[model samples]
Target: MDFYVAFNKTLNRFDLKAIDLARKTDLSMQRVSQFKDGFNVRVDTLQKLLEVMPQEAKRYMLTLVAEGETDSPPSTGG
Candidate 1:
């Protein structure tokens, strides 16, 4: 999943509304809305908000960042 899907999944699980996330993460409501809705999100804006995400969410994000270089999943079948 990309940033948009990731953000929405976390928000849904946390029962967080866009407005709540905007304030908590110090992001503009428009930015958060755009991301959650699958719009193009700026790297700087995303990075700043990511700084304040929950530990679990941030961990998930770290995994994504670390794996960004690999585009395909490993083959499983012999």
Candidate 2:
């Protein structure tokens, strides 16, 4: 899944709003909206966003990023 798709999924799962996330992450609403709209953000900004998410959501987003980095399916160990 695309980063934006994962991000939106996380937002939906948490019932979070961009304005609320901006306040929690200390990011501008514009930046958050741009990210939600699929624009790439700086790594530091992405880190800030992740920091405000719940652990489960953060892990899910990171897993997607890791999978994208490897360009392979995630291992499913028996």
Candidate 3:
């Protein structure tokens, strides 16, 4: 799955919106939405998002990275 798809799923799983995430990450809502829409996000932005996200979100993000490295990403419920 795409990073944005997983990201959106994480939000959905946690009952969070882009605006809420933006507020928590100290970013603009536009930036958060951009991530959801698959825009290229900066490392700092990614870091900020992860820092503020729930453990499930962080785990999902790790899963995405690990899958990318292994060329066989897992498909699991967010």
Candidate 4:
């Protein structure tokens, strides 16, 4: 399953609206909207969103992050 799909599913599970979540997490409304619209989110922004999620949903989101990190190419230092 796509990470964004999983994210939205977790949000739905908690009956959370994007606007409310953005406000609660102290993130910009545009940022949350962009995430809901499937724009790739930065790690720090994702962390902020996860921090506000319920424990169950947070665990699922972290699992997705771990999986994604495994799938990414390793960075080459300059």
Candidate 5:
């Protein structure tokens, strides 16, 4: 699954909203909304978001990302 897809699932599972995440992470609500809409964010910003997430949610998201990486075909040298 894509990062945004995993994020959305986590939010749904935890009954969280963008505003809730913004308040918890001290990030702008717009940034959270953008992330939910599939925009990329800085690594530190992502870390802050994860820091505020429930442990289970964090694990779920990580698992999704790992699974997605594993599902991709290996790259070959040109």
Candidate 6:
């Protein structure tokens, strides 16, 4: 399973949208869409996401990504 795909599910479970992430994080819709499209965002964007999530959730997200490391990197990471 793709990390971003799984991550998108997390966002969906919370009823979040790229537009909402963009608004709260002051990021462009394009950028947030890139994320939801299973793209690897800049490290800085992760920083913005970190700001919006609780520490526990952030830790879980990091763990989720790490668990997928051996699976594959997002195409956008290339």
Give the least accurate 10-residue stretch of model 2, judged by summed lDDT. Answer: 64-73
Residue 40, model 5: lDDT of 94
In model 3, where do residues sit more than 4 Å from their true spots? 68-78
Q: Give the per-residue lDDT digits (tens) of candidate 6, residues 1-78.
A: 465665675575556566777788999988888877878888899689667865665565666566664335445653
Residues 9-59 of candidate 1 have per-residue lDDT tens digits of: 666655657787678777889888888788998888777777767778766
Q: At residue 6, give the lDDT of candidate 1.
A: 64
User: 2 or 3: which has the higher TM-score?
Assistant: 2
Candidate 4 at residue 38, lDDT?
A: 87
Candidate 5 worst ten-residue window by lDDT? 68-77
Clashes of each: 0, 0, 0, 0, 0, 0
In model 6, what lDDT does residue 78 have? 35
Worst lDDT 10-window in candidate 6: 69-78
Top lDDT model:
5
Tens digit of per-residue lDDT, candidate 5, span 5-26: 8888888877877788799888
lDDT of 3 by residue, 7-58 (tens): 7777776786778779998899999889899998998998888888888777
RMSD to truth, every model: 4.2, 4.1, 5.6, 7.3, 5.1, 7.5
Order the candidate numbers by lDDT, best to worst.
Answer: 5, 2, 3, 4, 1, 6
For each candidate in turn, the TM-score is 0.67, 0.76, 0.74, 0.70, 0.81, 0.64
Model 4 lDDT at residue 76: 72
Better of 2 and 6 by lDDT: 2
lDDT of 1 at 45: 77
Candidate 1 colliding pairs: none
Clashing residue pairs found in predicted model 5? none
Q: How far out, in Å, is residue 51 in model 5?
A: 0.2
TM-score rank order:
5, 2, 3, 4, 1, 6
lDDT of 5 at 64: 73
Give candidate 6 misplaced runs (Cα > 4 Å).
1-3, 69-78
* Residue 33 alpha-carbon offset, candidate 3, angstroms: 0.6
